[model samples]
Every structure is written in C-alpha cells, then in structure tokens.
Target: MRSTFSSRLRRHALLGFLAIDMLGLVALVVDQVFSTDPVYPWIIAMGLVIAALPLLAQAVDYVLSTPADAAIVPDTGEKIP
Candidate 1:
C-alpha cells in the first residue's frame, strides 16, 4: 500500500475505535444513572463487537499484506526499505 493510504487507514481505524470507546463510556454513565434500564448493557456489549472490527481488519491486513506494503511506517511516515 502507498504510505499515504496506509496512514489514512490507520487514522480511520483509530477514529473508529475512539468512537466506540466514547459510546461505551456514555453507555456506562447511562447504565449507572438509570439502573432500571436494561438496554444500556446490550448497547455496551454491542460496542465491544463494534470495537473489535478494526482489530480484525488489521489482523487480516497484516496477514495478507506484502513486505513492501509494510515498509512504510504510518506513524513516522517513513519508508524502511
């Protein structure tokens, strides 16, 4: 993959995880404040699944990506080779 594309994917993945985390935190607050509501726990559980998608995608990308594709470090935007 191109360095710019790889970096974009990483950034989007991080954003996706951040969104799920924020939602989970909000759900936790709701669950605590409204103990009678049973939906919050389910929402929190769903958030867990949503959060795992990026990890799963990364795992697949790692397994299938070429060495050249991995040469570019997204964090530093540097090509190792």
Candidate 2:
C-alpha cells in the first residue's frame, strides 16, 4: 500500500513537471508571437517554480522516508562464500 502511494506521487510529480515545462515552452512562443507583454514569460516561470515546490517536497520526503543504510549499495566487489 505504501509503495503504491509512493509510486503514484512520483508519477504525478513527474507528469506535473513535464506539463509545466511543455506549457512554459508553448507560452513563451505564444507570448513572443501574439502578445507584446513580457509578463507572460514571468508568469510561466512562476508557474514552473510553484509546480516544482510540491515535487521537491515529495522528493525530499521520499528520500528521508527511506532508511539511511538502504541508500548505500552493498559491495558486490568481492563475493565471499
């Protein structure tokens, strides 16, 4: 159950980032071609930053939630029987 939720969060966060990046790109082009205002780019940047916040928080939580020792890969350098 826990893993499912964790995976879901990661999936959603990545999707959100992808969406924000694509939208920002589109907005930049639109602003350059159709709009004269420069604020649109700033607005897109702010949206990206805001969208990143939850992803950052969730990433930190995901890292911290795991056991410290688990982060280290075991040495497969020498196999001891």
Candidate 3:
C-alpha cells in the first residue's frame, strides 16, 4: 500500500479509537453519578481498555510501518560522527 493511504487509514483508526475512549469516559462518569457500587469497576476496566487501544494501535502501526534500523524520531539539532 501507498504511504499516504496507510497514514490516512492509521489516522482515521486512531480517531475512531479515541472516540470510543471518550465515550467510555462518559459512560464512567454517568455510571458514577447514577449508581453506587456495582458497575464502577466494570466501567473503569472498560474505560482503561478503550483508552489504551488507540495508543496500542499507534505503537503497532509505527513498528510495523517503519524500518527496524530507522530511528523513530531523528535528532534535528545536529549530527555527530
């Protein structure tokens, strides 16, 4: 696949995951406000997964897409031999 295509797909996937995380956050808040002791742990667990999915996706995408020998972010200030 072309780099542009892959990058755009990654961007959209991350955005989708982020939306899920945000919704999970809302769920957590709503649950907290309404109920007392039953759903909090479950909501928190789901929230953690939702929050981590995007970051995990990003790391996987970067590792799979990038060359193993290449630096993740190049040093822009100066280069020394």
Best by lDDT: 2
Instruction: Compose the digit string of candidate 3's lDDT tens values, residues 1-81.
Output: 698897878777776666676666666776777776756756775666676776766765675565676765567785645
Clashing pairs in 3: none
Residue range 38-58, candidate 2, lDDT tens digits:
877667666766767666657
TM-score of each: 0.45, 0.44, 0.43
- Model 2: number of clashes? 0
RMSD, one per candidate, in order: 10.3, 9.5, 9.2
Highest TM-score model number: 1
Model 2 residue runs over 4 Å out of place are: 36-81
Clashes of 3: 0
Query: Residue pairs in steric clash, candidate 1?
Result: none
lDDT tens readout by residue for model 1, 1-81: 698798778767766665666567766776787775678665765777576667756765675455775535454765556
Order of candidates by TM-score, top first? 1, 2, 3
Model 3 TM-score (2 dp): 0.43
